[model samples]
Target: MHDRPAPTPTPRSALPVQARLIVAVGIASALHVGKLPPALPLLAQELGLTLVQGGFLLSMIQFAGMTLGALLGQLADRLGPRRVMMVGLVLLAAGSALGAVAPGAAALLGTRGLEGVGFLMTVLPAPALLRRTVTEPGPLNRALGWWGAYMPIGAATGLLVTPLAYATIGWRLTWAVLAVLAALCAAGVRVYVAPDGPRARDAQAWAALRHGLHTTLSAPGPWLVASAFLMYSGQWLAVVGFLPTLYTEAGWSPARVGWASALVAGVNLTGNIAAGRLLARGVAPRSLLWTGYGAMALGAVGTFTAGAGLAYASALVFSAVGGLIPGTLFALAVRLAPGPQTVSTTVGWVQQWSSLGQFVGPPLVAALAARVGGWQWTWTVNVACCAVGALLAAALHARLAQQVRAPRPGQEGA
Candidate 1:
């Protein structure tokens, strides 16, 4: 008799359309974050802004995420991710529009701050929403993996398009264009994503808030995940943020610099998507993370030290392979949540650290480069971050292993 064939597992590509829509919302928010980079030179010229002020403008969007990410995450869990996200989109639209008309740096900075808060709200609860949207593990992994790429995807789109937009219509109109895009995204979310209505009262709300915060904050899982993200994010943003300057100094044109930087950011999606597929196929999350961090360490070292030709290639490999970390961490966030109710809170914690890293990383790298009179020593700082991240990944893997082998009492069979 012929041996029977095993049943085929569901394809990762089978993610639901609504889930994809949710991921698009995230991408839209990320576009807003990225739009300002290319516009910085124009802004500095128009506003007569100093270097310090310019740095603030770039990082202002992270203010809310740095200060209130966890709190917003808890809020999203209580009120509803869809509704909060809609509010976030509206804020992004308003901030972009307002910033477009600003008379000076002060006004523009304030608008950017509002955009930051909006961005925080838009992204904090996404993982939980994705978790709820995609119930099955295989498709969910793929979905979450794609979800992780939303940042680089949005950032790359903004980096590549904004400079072109500026050349055609000027910076003010470029800002207005993103405002329109944000508005459209808000409408899409309202129509497509199901809204959860307001829950009872302040009493129940307070209790839920406490529970979510405690659950996320008390767990070692969330801490490890958040810290690992911190280490990876700071270095990633620092390198990508400065690439345009580095290339321009080497005599690349404005257009070439923009496209090259965008491409480096864009290729990160390959690893993000692959991580989901590999996880769905039962690859160990720990292994993927180790590989990512290791690549980042080696890549940064080469990018700073190697000749120009190989440096770019190393950065590309660094970004592509490093994509595995976020994709895996996102999958792990859902699994390692203290319970169903706290998933968003855990993600919020991750976002909080991520914001902190982005806020600090660029400035830290800039300071180091200034001190050394060049970027030659850049790798020394970033490689340290990668090393720490790898260590944290090991700790997280051990924790996950423990949880898997010793399932909770009621969940033993499961």
Candidate 2:
């Protein structure tokens, strides 16, 4: 099996100022209005979709992200992260614009799916860019941390801004605004992100991909990590999925759900930043994964029983943790790749699995809720799922540790 090449560790002075700036903008562009789930139903209705259809609309974005991310990463490894990101940003603009003007439901979903592809293009290479541009650990982690916050921030911002857009110009206009944001992000990348070192170009991307996929598939970590995601993402979305309904259950107005979701998303943004900081402080990747999964489970349990204010508070706590897991886990996934060359491909596989999870999460919770009674039963199922996810995390972490600690043939005597 191939092993990930140890990154040529750089000192702090070597951190690329421009690269940091590019990724920061990349973050802003990728998630802008993307994370606002409240707008999903409205977008669906406008496109004449049923609930199941709307769900697929959302699911396909992730589905696209999963497949596209690895493809984009491979392209990044071959052509360059800079070229890939710029192209992605351009697509982001075009996709958003098209989605805004889409005449029918399928057209809108296709455009959004393209946008998801663009999102992956911009995001999947971010860490690769960081590894390439940054040498020092602290600033690298900080940059990655900031990168993580961008999604939740964008999502929360979308939630905050979309309401006004909906009230004023409508969802179409909101998409237009997103297009503008995407265009701006494209411009930033064009001006800022520098080219990779010549060696990165020499990389055998296809071979790396084939090798990475094979190795990652053979490993237990990927399965464990993927399984953990199934539960964590499932429970997390389940909790979020029923929120508006839950709010209504408590006799709250429609506006209450919006505010609650926004607040939860905002707090969730903090978790991304926290993930970077926590990793910088030197926690093992497995530990962070477990913490994230645990938090998701805990939040499900806590809010499952709470009402009104208490429910929102529980929501906030759980979301923050949920936000942290993606980047942290991505980081770990890369580390687990059989070879540095294959990291992107391996990570893509994980993404494909997560996309599968996104599909499973909401319905499973809904089914459980239907079968049993009340939010408590719903949460009980979610909690159980997440707890299993925790176990998966533990197992993955253990397996990954073995990969890191075991010496390669050449280094055995060292």
**Could you tell me the lDDT of residue 181 within candidate 2?**
81
Model 1's C-alpha root-mean-square deviation from the true structure amounts to: 5.6
Per-candidate TM-score against the hidden true structure: 0.94, 0.83
| Whole-structure CA lDDT of model 1 | 0.84
lDDT of each: 0.84, 0.65
Give the Cα-based TM-score of candidate 1 against the true structure.
0.94
Root-mean-square deviation per candidate = 5.6, 4.9
- Runs in model 1 deviating more than 4 A are 1-12, 50-52, 408-414
lDDT of 2 at 231: 63
lDDT of 1 by residue, 1-414 (tens): 434222233455676666888898888888886787777777767898754465567778888888888889889889888888889889989999999999999999899999999888888878877876776778888989999999889988888888888899998988898899899998997877666655649999999899889878998999999999998887887787678767867999879988998988888888898999999999998899999999999999999989988999989988899999899998888778787778788888888898888888877887788778888998988789988998998999899889989875444543
Candidate 1 residue 334 Cα shift, in angstroms, is: 1.0
In candidate 2, the residue pairs with backbone N, CA or C atoms under 3 Å apart (3 or more residues apart, or in different chains) clash, namely 2-338, 3-338, 3-339, 4-338, 4-339, 4-340, 5-340, 10-135, 10-136
